[model samples]
Target: MCGLDHHDDSLLEAMLENNLLFDSGVDGLYGRSGIFEDVIERFELLVRRLGAPDKATRIHFPPGMGRKTLEKSGYLKSFPHLAGGVHSFEGSDRDHAKLLGMLEAGEDWSDLQTPTDVFLTPAACYPLYPTVAQQGAVPDDGRLFELSSYCFRHEPSKDPARMQMFRMREFVRIGTPEQVCDFRESWLERGKTMIEGLGLPCHLDLASDPFFGRGGKMMAISQREQALKFELLIPVNSEETPTACLSFNYHQDHFGQTWGLQFEDGRTCHSACIGFGLERVALALFRHHGPDVEKWPAATRKLLWED
Candidate 1:
């Protein structure tokens, strides 16, 4: 939505209208062309405009990360429904031989093996938390880190926008609670302003996290009550359906306590993140503006291709 030109939206809508939505995963990424390049450039520009300080703090992680790291950060305990992990053979050589035989006989269930340590990263922020923690305490003041990470989830729905794997560009700020909260709030406003300025149909809403189970349900409620997460939703494929393009979260003492990160006064630090789903926004652009690149607004196209 931020980087697309007016005619670009028309072309996208036309493609979707013609049922040309390529299943980027499971089936695989194909026929992306300039559409993808534009998306990346726009995302970078958007991040820069969002006041990320500079590119030095930026990081890029492949779609997958280790399961142990995610588990240690309480990802499974919170959202086990979205958790995904790798499995491997656990049997002896004889058992392996039997399994291979089963496979040759077309009766194998090799997919049932228990996991080693690999898991799909559910969010861009997940991988960064432990890295920051292991790096030792936050500076005497604070630290700002940005990342454009490809993340994975298991919501295998038919929506082209909500793919199993997607991109997330985020800015994480870690420091004291006050600093973290302030940073989150500031980004919330900034996100809204930028979206509005771009003429996208969006709204800033109080958000509830998808915590797991009854206990997690209570935790989610309590977290929202304490103003821990906020999201910006915009209509993408359909007016009835709004995509969550941006999420602002305040992890008040959560990561800090878990990781032993300290501030200037030696108190545990707090953390917050501002995240954007790069692909989802691209989908939104298609929905709102249509898909003909040539027909896209000159101003918007210029902004996207500027850098």
Candidate 2:
């Protein structure tokens, strides 16, 4: 019951009993109840402690951003296995019917569609690059943007902490190479400090992107060579295995080139993001404190409820 085997079931049932289900999805339930309110209160306090932007940065809110940007960012080239895009086929009603039948039998129906221009945002930062690119050249001073977005993926497992669709509150900044690198490095320490302060046993680790295929393996190798990503790992359920709760990535002009984003100096703008998985953090709290809300630590419990 401590692992993914029962994680989804236990969390889902608890959420349901607590009336957290606002809608339903392929997974049978979705959305938040008062539970998210608890998570948000703590998150806001944490962000304030970390000196997050006083306001949401230049906003670009899109339901479905373009797929081409993901391609140019090497998303498809690197992590194709984890990437998901929208697909449709004409004259495939019969095929769709068969797929639906399989779904009724508990088989995945995603294989039936012919993917189109749309794609599932595996990471929250996917849409940010293209949106910023559309704005033309970045100012010499740089640009800062934040998006609280719902993102999707076919994850390694149905672990409650590793959801197929999760809320990601991401802060993105694009500008000179020096600025981007500095920003990312700064967050590395801040993120570690914040998580550690929350009383969660966590550690910082160099991260490698999960590449798509055999060729993707090569692209991931290149990313590693460039020292592109880092993640904060914490023990959620089992102390033997840690889960990545936060990840900071430095895109290093890769996205700027894709979106034709240039700097005042006529160089491609560098990019980086600090990502927070809201649900996973909540799950971490549950694991740390125990299932009974009454027995949870006073400091942690007070953060969630004002009344």
Highest TM-score scorer: 1
Q: What's the alpha carbon RMSD for model 2?
A: 4.8
Models 1 onward score TM values of: 0.84, 0.78
Looking at model 1, residue 283 earns an lDDT score of: 70
lDDT of each: 0.73, 0.70
For model 2, which pairs clash?
85-119, 87-115
Q: Write the per-residue lDDT of candidate 1 for residues 198-267, one digit (tens) a residue.
A: 5578998778887888898799889889877889998774556577889998888888887777865678
Worst lDDT window (10 residues) for model 2?
A: 1-10
Evaluated at residue 195, the lDDT of candidate 2 is 75
